[model samples]
Target chain A: MTAYKGYLIDLDGTVYRGKEIIPEAVEFVSSLKEQNLPYLFVTNNSSETPESVAQKLQNMGIPCETKHVFTSSMATASYLTEQREKQSAYVIGEDGIQKALEQAGITYEEDQPGFVVMGIDRSITYEKLAKAALAVRNGARFIATNKDVSLPSERGLLPGNGSFVSVISLSTGVEPTVIGKPESIIVEQALERINLSKEEVLMVGDNYDTDILAGINGGIDTLMVHTGVTTAEQLKEKQEQPTHVVSSLKEWKI
Target chain B: MTAYKGYLIDLDGTVYRGKEIIPEAVEFVSSLKEQNLPYLFVTNNSSETPESVAQKLQNMGIPCETKHVFTSSMATASYLTEQREKQSAYVIGEDGIQKALEQAGITYEEDQPGFVVMGIDRSITYEKLAKAALAVRNGARFIATNKDVSLPSERGLLPGNGSFVSVISLSTGVEPTVIGKPESIIVEQALERINLSKEEVLMVGDNYDTDILAGINGGIDTLMVHTGVTTAEQLKEKQEQPTHVVSSLKEWKI
Candidate 1:
């Protein structure tokens, strides 16, 4: 296997499943640290700040710092910053996205914003959605953190940020520039953050649709681990196969 | 003209615009009443009850009773009743849909509901959407009041029921049974309510997309007036034309 200089790892399915951490993934990440190879935990979750995400990883015996965590919210902020120097945004999200935008020096405006950014908001209301639709219709650039339609919960699969984002997109007939997994935007942003070329970085995740596809879309080699969503049986039917596939991270050399 | 025995009329654009009523529409309905022709006001609005709608029409000097108004909510309720004898539904909407379902004797059950009904809900929360999505994913029959993406409000075109409905439909990957105009479900239900055959009833409205398309889809003749949404120039681009077109309702001899 070609040794990569940097690793762009996925959370949830790869590092941990819900609250349970994968031991093999932890050992693999530790190996990356011992080899002095740069690695960042790239996540589509726009709800949690990097500090919080890193804290969770640390608690689970995984070596991670706030700087090692790259959320879609951070990627969105970076993308927006690159687009315009002083931009006003109409945001629909919780703490993680809001903090990211604030940290990126983006101002929040409701009436007529330069951009309309959407993330998963548990306190989502019709008024917020209306404002988003109106702003999008009024010619604001629409942006979404991720497009994961369903969120897996204890109860069942709940409506994800992508589903709520559809309200504005479908209403205003404007497609949002998605800055998360499978779209290449977030992957590109992560590569820039990690200071590595696409060839020098490897994207690792369990989900075939989001993680593997994101790597492929961003022109990066992918390592698909079968610890979460996608199974070995399901991967067989896929048209574009991942660069590398393993039953668990224990089998793969860092 | 065919001299239809009954008239199935559209609200909003056809009869009124917001709080303002069209004088020509009032005169046209008066003529219908003078001739003793049975008429029903069919609306895609799932927010207000038939009583409220009837009151609004009556206040505008348009002859209408609760029985004369047939909403998409009523159509949805009726459709559910016909689909199953004792059905349980997880609804996401306001008073109109709730009352209609209650009137139809359909019980509201959140856990593993038989059906998931979505309507225009201004007070929409993530929790409500989550439940609806979960129910739909859990094999519940998904139904939407209408597919009107946006609602024309005083501010602007706000996110309509269809937009909110997309949250569930997109999340669960389930296409809803839309019980409103342009689909023929609401029109079919309205026809049953008015006790009129397709040939004997003229669907009158100003909107070509909903009203005219509903008539065409339901195998009924349509009279398109130019008071609301679709203009004559816009209607000219349509392949399947209405049975009759008028600049004003006053120009048509009922």
Candidate 2:
């Protein structure tokens, strides 16, 4: 097997499910650290800052720092800076995205903006959506953190950021440029942050649709773990197979 | 022109635009009242009660009573009753839909509902959308008041009921049964309320896509007026034209 110099790992289903952490996954991450390998925890959750995410990992006894976390909000901020146009944006999100944009020095403008950036906002209101629709109709570039339709919670699957983003897109007749997994935008950004070429890094996650497809889309190898969303039986139905498969992350050799 | 026994008219674009009433449309309605022709204002608006809509029309001197108005909310209530199943729903809407459902004796059940009814809700929140998404995913029959993507407002086109409804639909991956113009469901209910056959009624309005298309879809004759949405040039582009065309409602002979 070809050795991967660095790793890009997924959260939620891979490391933990809801508030419960997977023991094997934690051990796997620890082993990577012991081997002196570089890794980053890439996530589609745009509601929390990297500092908060790192705190959550630390609480679970996982070795993580703020620099070890890469959120979709950070990716969205990176995407905006790359455009090099007007730096003003009409943002609809929570702490994570808001802080990320602020850190990137993007000014907030409600009436007219260069970009309309949306993420999962549990405090979403019709007025916010109305403003977004009006701005998009007036020809602002639309961007979304991620396109996960349903967010899994203890209560069940709730509406995700993609669902809220649909209000503006469907009303204004415009599609947003998504910046999370299943699209290569976030992956490329993560690659640059880790300072590694695609071939040298391996993407590891439990979900085939988002994580594995993201790796495939970004031209990187993927290790699909069965501890999360996709089962081995369901994996066989897919046309494209992941580079490696394991029942748990502990089975994968560094 | 064929002498129509009954008239099905639209409100927003036909009777008024925003807060101001159309002078010609008022005269046209007065003429219909003089001839003792049965007429009803069929609207896709699901925010206001029929009484409120009638009050609005009466204020404009259009000779209207509560019985003269038919809203998509009322049509939704009727649709639910017609199903004759569990008479309960998880509603995500304003006063119109809420009252209509109450009048129909449909109980509200958030936990486990028989239906998930949606309408234009300016007070929309993520919790409401989240609840609706969870309900729909858990096997509730989803229904929408209208599929009008954009609502023409003083500020510009705002997100309409369809846009809000898209959140639940997109998240749950379930298409709703729409009871509004451009869909024949609301028109069918309006036909029954007006006590007229499709052959005996003429649908009159300004918007070609909603008002005229509803007429065509309901198998009734349509009178396209150019006072509001669709202009003469735009109407000419459509393959299926309205049965009659006029610059204003005043031009049509009662």
Can you tell me which runs of candidate 2 are displaced by over 4 Å? none
Runs in model 1 lying further than 4 Å from the true structure = none
lDDT of 2 by residue, B25-119 (tens): 98999988999999999999898999999998899889999999999999999999999568899999899999999999999999889999999
TM-score of chain A of each: 0.98, 0.99
The fnat scores of all predictions, in order, read 0.95, 0.92
lDDT of 2 at B231: 90
List of chain B TM-scores, one per candidate: 0.98, 0.98
Q: B186-219, model 1: which lDDT tens digit per residue?
A: 9899889999788899999999999999999999
TM-score of each: 0.98, 0.97
The residue pairs found clashing in candidate 2 are: none
lDDT of 1 by residue, A194-223 (tens): 999988999999999999999999999999
Residue B222, candidate 1: alpha-carbon lDDT? 94
